[model samples]
Target: MLKNKFFLIVAILLVFFVVYYTFFGGNTASVDGLEATINPATYGRQVVEKRTEKDQFLRTNAESPILDKASFRGLSYFAPDVSYRVVARLEPFADKTQKLVVSMSDGSEEVYEKFAHAVFSLHGEACRLLVVKLENTYSILFRDSTSGKETYGGGRYIELDPKQLTDNHAIIDFNTAYNPYCAYNPRYACPLPPTENKLPVAIKSGEKYIAHE
Candidate 1:
């Protein structure tokens, strides 16, 4: 009888440890908490759920690409006349030069003109810089940055779409930046932002990195 009781006690303890480790004892929980605090609208519960859904979609879907080809056939707008520069290199994870492109936009009719080059840190990893001009807007894609640490590791992406690109004006807002689908799941191969796209300053805007359960 005593032996049976002892075995039962051991089993109970094992179950408790498993529960703790699976839920509250890992980095997953911490990431969940961060997502909750950042997403005030859903009150945090939906953050994990949304991430899960995105992961599932990326894993099962096969048509998504790292960078979607831009359609600028009908776009006609002069470049913006904005003067902005990267004040710092928050983190670098690529081999190419970092740059900042500012658009001259006044709320309506944005335009992307020139890009200012800057230095970046590779964060002990190697990456490449890809510059693609689509339609009337320009895209800078690269990998390796504070994105995984402060943002998403799969890398964050910023674009100056036609709507935001106007004559001598562009709407460059970090808050509007977002993570690619690959950030949620490893199955997806989203394009990493180029080193040139890395901003020297901390863009405290846009979506924050999320942790999956």
Candidate 2:
């Protein structure tokens, strides 16, 4: 009977820990668990932590996109700014079965399901972007005025966690946008951003690239 009670107590503690972390974890990326009172300093630190982890992975991971790992000096990124983190209202597509075919870097095409339209305002300008289900998670493929100047001309992607969606709203943080693998290696066949995803504004956040030949 003592053993049975101990097992029951352990199970209860495990459940409590799971519930507590799900609601109070300091996961900056997860809008669902992110604290509402997070300040810029804390958010910036969390973003830095994520970037550091990515750098470590790219430097040591065998599957890294960098061909010459010896010369990789880590990726460049704009300063973390909370201003770029905006809450967007997701509008579901009327035709849920809609599929979008996008051109690939290697002269091919890939099909993705139209997820929703993320409507938000950035820098006092109202903007809307098409979100698509690219494999497992929803992603936004976009090209801004910074393309070809400060960022990759082929565009960048911002992946959205399905768990981050709360009441048809999601936090879209441009600071986390990243270049496609093709930016590092031409051998990669990355999907290009559709024309509709192009933005007139210059997004100064996210990753930057300079071709090294």
Best by lDDT: 2
Give the Cα error of residue 164 in candidate 2, in Å.
1.7
Per-residue lDDT of candidate 2, residues 47-84 (tens digit): 89899989888878998888777887778999898888
- List the pairs of residues colliding in candidate 2: none
After superposition on all C-alphas, the RMSD of every candidate to the true structure, in Å, is: 17.1, 8.5
| Highest TM-score scorer | 2
- Please identify model 1 stretches exceeding 4 Å from their true place: 1-131, 134-145
Residue 204, candidate 2: C-alpha displacement in angstroms: 0.8
Model 2, stretches more than 4 Å misplaced?
1-37
What is the Cα-based lDDT of residue 4 in candidate 1?
100
Q: Superposing every Cα of model 1 onto the true structure, what RMSD results?
A: 17.1
Give Cα-based local distance difference scores for all models.
Answer: 0.42, 0.85
